[model samples]
Target: RVRSASYGGTQMRYRLQAGATELHAAAPAMHAHAPGNEVTLALPPERLWILPVEQ
Candidate 1:
């Protein structure tokens, strides 16, 4: 999952979770990160994509 705050605002921190995994994550402008199968985060106008992981 992904979430975002405006580029010009009180910058805050966020905690991301998936099952038992937790990530201390933040988006500075257009941050894009993909860490696993079917997960993507594009932020600062938060966008998310879950693409299939081909095996």
Candidate 2:
């Protein structure tokens, strides 16, 4: 469920929940992020980064 969102000029902040987890994501403002609205997340390979965890 989507909690809330704040729209900026070219980006927006979104708060969402999935079970016991809550996520705050930032992305381009190409769509409306109204409160209580459901949203889909897509991360392409070009936008993905892999980092090694320190032991």
lDDT of each: 0.46, 0.79
Q: Candidate 1 residues 1-20, lDDT tens each?
A: 43322333434344555567
Q: What CA RMSD would you report for each candidate?
A: 11.1, 3.5
* Clash statistics: count for each candidate: 0, 0
Task: State every prediction's TM-score relative to the real structure.
Answer: 0.30, 0.64
lDDT tens readout by residue for model 2, 1-55: 6788899789988898867977777778987678888777776879776667669
Clashing pairs in 1: none
- Shift in Å, residue 46, candidate 1: 20
Best by lDDT, which number? 2
